[model samples]
Target: MRGEGSAASAAGGISGGDGGASGTVPPPRGGSRRGGSRRGGGPANRRGRRRVLRWVASVLSLLILGTGAAGYLYYRHLNGSIQTDALNLGETKLGGSKPNAFGQTPLNILIIGSDARNDAANQALGGATETFDGPPLADVQMLLHLSADRSNMSVVSMPRDTMLMMPKCTEANGTVHEASKGLVQTNESLSRGGPGCTVAAWTELTKIPIDHFMMIDFKGVVSMADAIGGVPVCVEQNVHSRTRDGKGSGLKLPAGTTNIQGEQALQWLRTRYGFEDGTDIGRTHAQHQYMNSMAREFRKNAKLTNPVKLNSLAQAAIEAMVVDPGLNKIDKLFDLSMELKKVPPGRITMTTMPWIYSTRPGLDGRVEPKAGEAEDLFRMVREDIALDGQGSGTPASAGSSPAPSASAPGTAGTAQSAPPAATAAAPAKIAVSVRNATGGKDGAQAKAKGRATEVATLLAGKGFTKAVADTQTGAEDTTVVRFATDRQAADAAALATALGLPASSVEKSGEVPGIVLYVGKDWRTGDAPPAPAPAPTKAPDSAHPLNGDNDKACMAIQPGFTW
Candidate 1:
């Protein structure tokens, strides 16, 4: 939110696109109002009811998805409500996702919750009325990944207080916001341009292609909460998120399970001090609880069968969001909803980016991405490997890179078998960026000095004369060879193979210009990278993954805030 350089990291869901049943959109077939239909429980009616209810489940897919796809019936009016903008304002756009063996590709959308007090409704919802008409801040950022099979989904949230290098972004109106001098709070990236800039920062950080973006402000969360009915949640003790000088969310709830809706629902998600240790990280955990509970409650609610309620919720949501041009139309949105509907709640996994406070003196309060585990987590998503540790891939137990297995381009963890020999351009012709990512694990400094140049020289000696070393340094637990396009996959694989790295150590990244070979701590002094480590069998505890079907989840109140 950073409305006060802060954020509520509002509850998120897939945003919707159409209007209510009363509007222009047609009612779902086979089902009709009780008085309007002579045969109430006919086969078609049953089918229609199931179909209609499934659509509802998809829209409320989470905090944002459920609210986004429901309003197309009003057609023109609902369409007008959806504000469209440029998709990616970054200088270089990543290529499209490669399809699986079945010609299916995964879907990636960035959900942004902005803290904009431009209008009265927003000003009230986002308190601090004095700061009206201020620049919007993306307080909440979540990356939603729908697998190529459409059988599983993963959501990764970036805490608002995270510190990262903001990429250089250019606005549609010809305004240029130079990249930050150093790492800045992730929320501040929104002010660099618009949501596209935030999109740019994410792509740069995670090296994932962002197909679309949906942004909603404080009021949008409040409006959609009513349509979601009451979401059941449990607390360990009676807690109040309030302080002596009015510095908390003002939420007071008795211990145990309770149904929450409307502003109280919003408060439930926004209250940080009462939920945990009063940090943004703890608030992120609370948000996950709300989202998971919402998905479960939505699936069981009988009211979801009513097309009227679905449309109303959908309309209110699309009207409140700013989306990329790719999702501006109703049919496109409906199509997205259908894909989301295919993924059951049990297959959905939600995680917050594992992070630790910045060690830099002035920025110690700000958080930085946790090492190793975070990299492994992102690698799993890039490969369409479900974080819930199910299906296709090796067990998710230890590390990410599997032992050299196939010659294929990096994707679809199971379908990595490429041609017997994937062809690559001549060694001299390929442009490779060799970066030194040595050390930093367990409080170790970058001990391998000139490692990037040494590796670059090694590549040159091997006939890859175009290999160049980057001056910037980073921390990588193990060595990895990353490439941009699929065409470059063969070359990347060739490089990894040359370095004796495993097939799993080679990955596809959207932000790289070409192939990047990072000499990590694992290969600090050796000519060849280390052998592939064991793959992880489960998500680490630091990620705090919450599955949609887990109804037993309960938030523990902070000792200071609890009764």
Candidate 2:
């Protein structure tokens, strides 16, 4: 309920009236007054006019009643289709990140695509082969970010193989999980409790509060695609996916565009080996393309304006999803959609969490957070920064009202207002001191020893010759950079950029002697922070950039995937 009051109006609202233009009164022909001849005519003509009027009145009455009844029935049906789940992921604490200038805070939603094969039909879709009702892995996880002003949306997908420490979560049955100390696979969070647990894991990792979650199983994908009519996808070459043992998505398409729905849509999303490099990263890119195109299709088709299409879409989506109680209403979903649709396709972006191959032998083939780049992306979201540098707004009325800009992470303004001014001193010339506040005599880092010195060495290697370790220390949850004087603010900001720390983590401290850093538990092991993130206007090279309607873009097939 943190943002319930503003979620409706700030986000656009879709009126759910039946689609059609209102009937208009017609004018007389050739400047003649309507019914003038009938009025002047004899008794027979008058009688005829009276009969016609009666017939018209009767017909209009029936039409009105019929329309009202149909509309009510449809509304009830759509509402009934939705399934609700109490998001008993335990209490969520706000990260205290600043809202936009207008006092509107961002909304983060975790969408989970579960691989539960509970039914016979679902079992055929391919999942864990052992048991039908057994716990399932969260196959697809995407965090959708709605900007504070509702101007732009960013969908950040987390790979299933990525490892992270999950926060303790409470299940709907009143069971509680102790907070995990060791790094665990992210997908396991779902099995621990429910989709709420998945949300909790993310909250623990990013420190970003999640408002709600919408989860769907394998069958939901098929139903949703069918309801949306069809989503168009393209590929660069002919491909046929299959494995020697007959395990695969069974997807086959010629080297061009295809309108996929139902099973084909599921295949397109689930395909991995034939998509790009045959890794989860490659599959994630393909999913982004499908989603981007789907958004364009929804806008182009005008589902909200057409009652039939709208009802079908609403029913299909609702029936397919298990949502947090907060988002279980059709109106809420429509409002959320309208908010998202406000941003032009060009402004909406889809990116994956940066990751690296796991080195631990037991977890081989798995991936771990790429550290710097991943944190940088999360920080951008936490601050409500648009991925694209340009301001965002509704494409239909962008000329009339432009959206606020990505002035700085967690702020709004023109690009000119973004920080790290051109006159800031170079990194090498700026003095920096890092304190290992991860723990004390009996703390986690105490056993590791000399972590502050190690990080200082890492900083020195990055060209900050004056970088050194500090003696003062206390427990800190996240890493932060502080500067003593306003003059050194730019230098502190520069150092944060180099270390890939969020702009929110940089603060002014009058008591500090120089640019000082306190390395928190978040950075106990990394050699150095990730490279400075690209400006909002720029994207990391690894990201697959596509506008909402990138009709010309096509997925490239891997060598073995060629038909």
Candidate 3:
């Protein structure tokens, strides 16, 4: 009922008849032309005019009827694409029930852009051969958080290079893998198990339950963009890049507003080397901007008022999306679309989960979130609160109530215990070093190390018997918690929560080869010994960068795999 006005109007336009709400009537046939001079017109001219009017009316009626039929067909197609089998009601995690300023329920959706090319259609898109290259990776991972009141939304992109514990996944092909036995890449989970595994990994890593998921791939994106004509985007500078397959997928645009469609839109989303940092994080911002621009264009364009175009866009979107089974239902999608329509583009915010680059001993360089930063982010969503500019928030200081904890042990307020059996592994012996990232002339670095030592001691108290505190480093402005291995990292997460540390304050890095606690300027030391400065690594630039070719291929194959 809240959206009845818009929904009714939209529906009326599709129904091939006027709703009478606009107060306009169809003109009477030949009334204006004939006027009072009907006698002045010859019989032949009158007949011809009448015939022409009748033909025009017939054509207009057919057009309206055709539009209505198309709309009905599109709605039916959308209903069919919903995968009921893919719905995991029990697995869905809702953020806290706290209402935002607008008093709406806040929702977080995990959008996965998979790289699997197992499907024939997907393989064709990526130009794949039959050499068992494994399914495509989930090159693009975004957590879209909508405010409780549905007035504000934020899309946070998680870098795939981010090193975190991957939950054991059960692939759609019926293959089961154990979490402890294998070291998995973040994006690989999508290929191994599908979106469900990706969801599990996210839940395990962030401790935040995902409510729904929407997956889209290349063709769908292209078609959808084309259907809406083209989306206008602003680039600060010129951008040029090639696709992974050595194709000329270069993006050439001036430093101004440009309307891009078809492959060009895809290219813009895929262009990395020409963008800032040349990382997936850079592309995330570009995509966010594109989405924002598209939303604005959609709202401003009266062409969508044409039932045919509206039906085309809707069909394209539905066909391209792979949704959780729970969302496959028409009623559910209808409700969601209605809710989404209420929120304007300006209200939507986009950001990347803040991260720092770190190099692992054997593994390649990876991006890691600053310590406790991710946790704080999750907590903000749980409490339906907006994050600060730095993605930092204090539960107590924010004056918001805490969210309900998972009934499972080790969650908020739950009895302190080990992680779930599926996630538990042998703890590793590791030393932690905490340093002040914020530059200061004072003994701030030492002070940060002291907090790190305190965290280390807290971990030791919580069954991480070998946890030891080490010295601080002169890392700039970012707080991070590094781990030696996947097992120790998961242990650290549990320990951090038990110690009442913010989740955002906890981070896991595969690079340090041991636990290192890096405290930011925001952290304070408690009753713990001050740690020593940590040994710096070798020349930082020598670290192995990501395989750019593989990365491009992974990006190109994403849209098809997910959809």
Say which candidate scores most in TM-score: 1
Per-prediction TM-score to the true structure, in the order listed? 0.73, 0.64, 0.55
- Can you write out model 1's per-residue Cα lDDT over 155-198, one digit (the tens) per residue? 89887767888878889888988877777778777788898998
The digit string of per-residue lDDT tens for model 3 on 1-563 reads 11111333222211111101111211111111111211112331111111111111111111222223335444655577644324221221222232323223446667776544445554444432432265545556777665554455555667666666665665556667556443345766665467777777776666555777766554334345455477677665554432232222245565567787655665565544344543345555566566666566656663344566656556655555677765665545555554455455555555566666545453344566665555555555555554322221221225554332222111212322222322534444434454444343234454443554566666676566666655545443434455555566565555454445544444443246555565555445453323323322211112111211111211222111111
TM accuracy, model 1? 0.73
Give the TM-score comparing model 3 with the true structure, all chains together.
0.55
User: What digit string (tens of lDDT, one per residue) describes model 2 on residues 1-563?
Assistant: 11111223111111110011112211111100111221122321211100101111111111221222333345554666777775547344332234454335567877776656567645544423444566766656878787766677777888777777776777767798877787677877888788878877787677666776777654333434565577798999987544333323456788899887655665566555466765556767887787777767765664344456445544544555677877666555544544454466667878888778777655655677785677767777877777665554432342443333332221222222212234678767989888877763236555236878998898889889889988876566677787776688678878888888867667655346888888877677777654444535434444455555466778888666576
- Specify the poorest-scoring 10-residue window by lDDT in model 2: 12-21
Q: What is candidate 2's local distance difference test score?
A: 0.59
Q: How many clashes in each candidate?
A: 31, 2, 32
Candidate 1: C-alpha RMSD to true structure equals: 14.2
RMSD of each: 14.2, 21.4, 20.6
